[model samples]
Target: MLLLGLFSHLLSSGKFWTTRRTNASQHIDIRFVFVIFFLLKWSHAQGSHPPRIVEHPIDTTVPRHEPATLNCKAEGSPTPTIQWFKDGVPLKILPGSHRITLPAGGLFFLKNDEPSASLKIFSADKDGLELEVKGAAPTVLRDEFRLEPQNTRIAQGDTALLECAAPRGIPEPAVSWKKGGQKLDLDSTKRIRIVDGGNLAIQDARQSDEGQYQCIAKNPVGVRESVLATLKVHVKPFIIRGPHDQTVLEGSSVTFPCRVGGDPMPDVLWLRTASGGNMPLDRVSVLEDRSLRLERVTIADEGEYSCEADNVVGAISAMGTLTVFAPPKFIQRPISKSIELGADTSFECRASGNPRPTLFWTIKNNRTIVFPGAPPLDRFQSINTEEGHSILTLTNFQRTDRDLVVVCNAMNEVATITARAQLTLDSQEDRPPPIIIAGPVNQTLPVKSLATLQCKAIGLPNPTISWYRDGIPVHPNAKVNITAAGDLIISDLDRKEDQGLYTCVASSRTGKSTWSGYLRIEVPTNPNIKFYRAPEQTKCPNAPGQPTILNASANALTIV
Candidate 1:
């Protein structure tokens, strides 16, 4: 087939020259054309030999980057058009790609290019492959030392791997590493090592690991130096001297010192992290000389201060506690409050000091806490500072509370202050009967479950609650418990026995009143049966040795 292509090309060229005559005098000589055509037919009759490969390509293991050549010469009547293939695929020939085939069928593989595995030779005329590509030889390509990862940054406690390679050397080069003019010890501990494939590795990089690194490749041919690479180990900021706690008197000067060290020099900031939010550093007195200073330190200036340092790599913070000694001083003391009977009122006071002063309300009789038996709603409640006020509430003022003097006590480690406020009340009307305030509403519940009938009443002179079941006094037992708030809890209730009208009677020295609610306990009943059907497999028995096949139709699974 290759010979036939060459024969056809020769015939075509001969016809073109004769048909387009350069001179009019030159005419087509029919005899010459006949002779040329005859010669071609005679040659075809003689039978030309198909292209046969004399030199074959073989497998080679060259250096990673080295020039290569694959010879594919053939012996035939006419020269063959050689096409190269790798891994069963035709190679696309490009002139500037450093990998190309010449007119004579010589193939070139430039440096830094990988020649394929399983080199195959084919005739462009599709005459089938005839080359014997016996696979062998390690052909390494040529390249000077080149190190990967020119520069890198990794945090401490991580591994660093840097590889340096020397390609195409006659003898494999010995690789050595250096950092900061000191020879790197590739020891047996494997911490700092030169591993397989000329890799320099370090385990758990530290501050000492930060340095410019170089890889040297040496052989009898020459010594090569790789481009300098840097191993930057990111280190978090650490306070070397600071986070010192100081306790100073008010109107004293104080300073917080902080020292930190890391690579790339980090930024520093002082912050006061509070539950409310971060207080901007500018809001407080500070000095930027690696320290924070407070000239006239007061309670407001006392807090846990932070020194934070950060860089592109990481960040860290150190806290220093500042304590300013200040005696308790009332910022605002509770004033005397006058209100009508049965009115709700609040008594408030606030003080500022370091070591935070505890504020409390003390009655004239030295009672700092309201009686435990007092209704939860009518008790003296402490207001949280989140509301911007420190207060104690006096709910439902009565005649007995009139003229009662109460003291607001604020104390800290330094000192204590007491401010008194006398309650002045107008003449009050007679105490009214208890009025039901919440719950004890009618309800239906499942049997064997727990239930609470909350009965809350509000009145003057404090009320005492009593419960009755079916008009009779009810006593608390294991399954029936009455809370201090007069709410009744029935546990493991019976369906029929626990269903009844329940009453709550509240009474005080002033008067008595009653309220009622009803409970219906429901026990669950079994679901009624509708219909049942035997499965088809049980109703229609299959013959022995025969399988019961299920229907595959869409309606086979319809539910009733």
Candidate 2:
């Protein structure tokens, strides 16, 4: 019985020790799980904050000689200590070489060390620098730029646009525009505007807008200009007067006007249509202010006219018509008076005006006739106005009709005028017969003798006395004497032939009268006859009253 009680006490003591060890192991495992959960939560919260930036806030673009700022910030427990590094080396604080100041209350300051702060630079290169903060470097720049409106065209009234851009720049560039060296002025009314991309814009375009345009972009480190872009504005010429056409009198005047508008003033010209001839032109006149003028217009002046305007940029033209006008007046005299008969006669009938008038002769017999000559008489004639004042001669005046009339007529010109006269016949009592007479009918006459002759006449207007001999009209010669008492006396007659017939004549308007006279001469017979007989003498014959011949030497014999 004593050995069984000692074995039961040893088993109970072993059970209590196993239970205490199990409880202690469970408490240690729970504590380890709680610590692991807190660590994971803290790591996730730190990742949510923005990364610390240490380079320039703006990127890639800067103008030369302009101010640039560098930034350095940190995000950590107790604000982790901040420092700067360049080219993989730590920077030391130096006196007078570095100016450090805190703008924002962060655990960092700006570095003003010009030489040390400068990043790697390339004149044409656009890439920016990488900055290191707290032994870690991050890329801090994003930049983009472009010019707007690749290509475009515009008419005079239409609108147009030009643009430039840089979406994001480290330091945004100032943008501007120029055309052929002149700056552009912008207006909202003109539809011109500028935007964020640094673009240049043009709203309305005209022919004057057709040229080169330049776009400029500038930043702190440098400035850039874009290649020239050309714009073209197209337009046609406009006519001021709608199809200006007209007609005018041939000897008058005409005018045509043309007007145009553009950036550059356009040229204007006038041209003709028929021969394509150009009209001479000058600057607008004060009187008419038109493009053309035609004075003293004529048929040859009729034609179409063209108005043309042009510039180095463009050109245009318009057309018009012109017409000319012509009209008719009298050319010769119509009145005449005073003419005669048995002689030539003529009259003039001339009518004066524009367009010559036709002339004809109208006789008193109511007959219309051309002039009497072979070819025909002209408008004028000459007549003798002597005896019959108003009489027109028909050549030899015969016992024809009494009152004759002569009229000159101009057809389609004027009224006619007539000239007339009365014809008279001669009387027989006004005519006279010729006369003759004779006297002094003896032949033989003594030296001193008287001769007488008688004269008579017959005529209408009385005849005068005159005598002629040997073809001479009885004028006194050297030794001849004449008396007005109607008798001839001869003082001493030397020859028997001195006695002959003499003639006396008288004449008058009606006829002629003539007379003749004669005279005789006598001589005494011989008183004594003496005869001488020579040695041998011949006998003479003796007839009827013959006397016998008696001869004596010294004495005379008488015969009875």
The lDDT per prediction is: 0.63, 0.43
List ranges where model 1 is wrong by over 4 Å. 1-141, 145-158, 168-190, 204-213, 216-224, 230-236, 244-254, 263-266, 275-289, 295-304, 311-314, 321-409, 420-560
Candidate 1 TM-score, true structure as reference: 0.37
What tens-digit string does per-residue lDDT give for candidate 2 at 1-560?
A: 22123224434344221001111111110000000000112222333432234333322222222334444444433233444443323445565543342443121223221221223211111221122222111111123345444455566766656666643332456777777877777653345566545565555656677787777666554555666777777654455553378867656777776767544566676666685573433321313344576677766666787777776556778888876544211122322322232433434444322122234445654453544232432322323222212212244433342233455443332233333322232223333433442222344444444333334443333446665432345554443434453333344544443555556666654456556555444442323422221111124232356443221111232233
Per-residue CA lDDT of model 1 for 495-541, tens digit only, reads 67687988989887657778888877765452442222223223645
In Å, residue 232's CA in model 1 sits off its true spot by 5.9
Tell me model 1's lDDT, rounded to 2 decimals: 0.63
Clash totals, every prediction: 16, 36
